[model samples]
Target: MSEQNLSSLTNIPSTEVAHENYLLAKLILEIQQTPDEYLPNLLQIVRLFRESVTMKPVSSDAWVKAMDGIKNPHPVKKAVQQIALSELLRKWEEDGDEEEQTETAEILCQNLEENPVSI
Candidate 1:
């Protein structure tokens, strides 16, 4: 008599599958015991769960296609940019020690020298 290969044996149930089965059983029991008025709310939650489980992720191409209609995706007005820079300077001026304040001011001056704002 010859021995069969171990590889030919059927796959055993995984812990994840067993956990899912247990959760489903618990949910079924809860649904049965739930009050009549709350059953509708529970069913809605179940429907939402089902939808979430089946929902597929949007692809990059899909995202590009969806956004193609917009002319300016992120338009930053000149006034808004100026206001942001002023607000940043105001915040730096209000807080920090003298040494730290001087360091920040130097850094800001270096950045402005590197990249001069047109507006």
Candidate 2:
């Protein structure tokens, strides 16, 4: 939509984003499963979502999706859900051998020390 059209439309204040935690994940899944021929407007939707979040950062699980999009989004919402999934796999890298776990634990300890508890 044009800037004029966006300005003319009813506005949604930053304090009131109408999306759930996993909404982005769901949307990405749909976009990925959906054939490319049906996604002429996907880029517009993604841009809108990016703007909404930028206006007011929400505690959203879709941050992963955002990161994936940044790293490598499909050609105008063709299907970057796989990218998000690939990023998500980094979480499992921690479940590894003894040396890796110990190194990870050390890093976590150092981070905790750097940012001590504030209770």
TM-score leader: 1
| Per-prediction TM-score to the true structure, in the order listed | 0.37, 0.23
* Model 1 lDDT per residue over 24-111, tens place: 5555655756899998899899899999999999999987876763433334665676789889878878876789989988998899
User: Which window of 10 residues has the lowest lDDT sum in candidate 1?
Assistant: 1-10
lDDT of 2 by residue, 41-118 (tens): 877777898888889564567888787766665664544554564465466464567777678769978997997632
**Candidate 2 residue runs with Cα over 4 Å from true position:** 1-25, 56-119
Off by over 4 Å in 1: 1-17, 65-119
How much is 50 displaced in model 2, in angstroms? Answer: 1.5
lDDT of 1: 0.67
Model 2 residue 6 CA deviation (Å) reads 35
